[model samples]
Target: MKPKKILLMGVSGSGKSLIGSLIAQRLAVPFYDGDDYHPEKNVKKMRQGIPLSDADRQGWLRTLNRLFVNNDEVVIACSALKNEYRETLRQNNEDMIIVFLRGDFDTIWSRHKQRTDHYFNGEDMLKSQFETLVEPTLDEAIFIDITHNAEDVVNAVMRALQN
Candidate 1:
């Protein structure tokens, strides 16, 4: 069966929100951007170009986990940069589908530069995310290259989930 909970994870600017929303729309499920759930303090830090520490993100991660626990089905876009963070998210949602949006620093950095509205757009912040990232293996999650066009990337994820 297809997974009920879907998580799109990667470094900042890896198109998690964009692709996750599309996937959720196609599936007729709710879409949640993990960024929106962050506390104001975290938002302020990121807006000021400060990288958040793990402790700063723990509460936010737990909140997202609670969202997952309460929802029947959802598509969530979160960085999930570290293995421990992903574990926290998986607390009660072991069957969740995780899609790792893979892209190089330069590719994601270029995308980050195009954004003017997001709080997490600094180069240093993006670099820190990459440094913190612990990518999942093939056995752990479906991986999609962000170099592809949006529609194609979504299609790839759909196909991957079917198997």
Candidate 2:
């Protein structure tokens, strides 16, 4: 089967990386972490518990668009919280398939607390992520409930793609 580009999106600590990795592996494609594309200034701001403005993210989104343009098949993990951000990516590549990792606040908070090395603190930015999220409707993207195991989530996404 030909590989497809998949964008795994959600708030911080929502298992985008884990699930995206599994999906990419299953599809035999590369997986890119959108965080890795962020400018140093943006990373620094997040490290300082400062939320990034749309201006702060514009460059990053453009970078992501470049990656999508360059690759024929890949998986990307991005905290595409807003509708506009997702729309920006979609505009760059109409064939892009977005997999939204939807989870409740408590679930994400618990996962955040378990993470140690990441720059974002669950308590400090959870509210901001939640507030920024304009939940994608059925018409917007493929939604996956992330209240289960990572393997299950990946399986669900794959099944959805097949149908």
Candidate 3:
């Protein structure tokens, strides 16, 4: 069956929000940018260049997970950088299809440098995310390289979901 619950995951600057929103629009589903759900304290910490500890994210992850539970179909762009975080999101939403947007640090950093209006755009925070990333294998997710243009990337995700 075509997946109705999709989570686009990666470190910041990997285009999760852009690709996820496009995929959701194509599928006629709702799109939720996980960044929007973060607690204000977390945002403040990130804005000050502090890396969030797992404790800081527990409530936030659960909140995002509820979005999955409450919706029949949803596309969420989240930086589920750790396996535990992904597990938190999958609690009652086992059918969720995770799309890992893969890209090297240099490629993502180049993109990050161009962003001007986000609280989590620090180079150190991006590096911290990479360090915390527990990449899901092919069995765990549909991996899409983020070097492609946004349209191409979304097309790739759509094709993967068709399978």
Candidate 4:
């Protein structure tokens, strides 16, 4: 079945925003970046090289999930780093399809470093992200490599949804 909602998940530099936008445009659905939903406090924390504790994320996760509540035909780009976080996102949604964009540290770190205007800074934040990540199982998501070009990633996601 075609998922009513889709989530692109990964670390800070894993291309969630770029690819999510592409997929949403292709699907002709609304695209929401989870980063945009973060509270100022969370943004300030990450900007200062601080990793959010699960407690710190509770409200954020619930807020993201709320965006999905009673909604579908949408895509969201988020750093759903742990199982609990993913669960939070899935709270009211059974037709949510999550795509995990996996990439090597060096590759993603390089991308993060080259970014000019993003809030996430460098290796320190990247390290915290990886440390927090709990690789999703096949049952939970479709895993794609972030190394793939935008076209390839979008095509893959489309194909995956068709199946």
Best by lDDT: 3
Per-residue lDDT of model 1, residues 3-90, tens digit only: 7999999998999999999999999999999999999999999999999999999999999999899999999999998889999999
In candidate 2, how many Å is residue 24 off? 0.4
- After best superposition, candidate 3 residue 89: deviation in angstroms? 0.4
Comparing 1 with 4 on lDDT, the higher-scoring candidate is 1
Looking at candidate 2, what is the lDDT of residue 161?
Answer: 86
Clashing pairs in 1: none
The local lDDT score (0 to 100) that residue 62 gets in candidate 2 is 84
lDDT of 4 by residue, 1-163 (tens): 5677998999988999999999989888889999998899988988888888899889988988988875668899999999989999999787799999999899898888789977777688899899889999998999887787888988888888787
RMSD of each: 0.8, 1.1, 0.7, 1.1
Instruction: For residue 29, give model 1's deviation from the true position in Å.
Output: 0.5
- The candidate, 2 or 3, that scores higher on lDDT is 3
Model 2 gets an lDDT of 0.88
- For model 4 the local lDDT of residue 112 reads 83
Tens digits of per-residue lDDT for model 2 on 1-163? 4447888999999999899888988898999999999999998999988988999999999889788878999999999988899877876588888889999999999999899889776476888999889988887789999999988998899998887
lDDT over C-alpha atoms for residue 90 of model 1: 95
Clashes of 3: 0
lDDT of 3 by residue, 114-138 (tens): 9998898678888999999999978
Give all TM-scores, in the order shown.
Answer: 0.98, 0.96, 0.98, 0.96
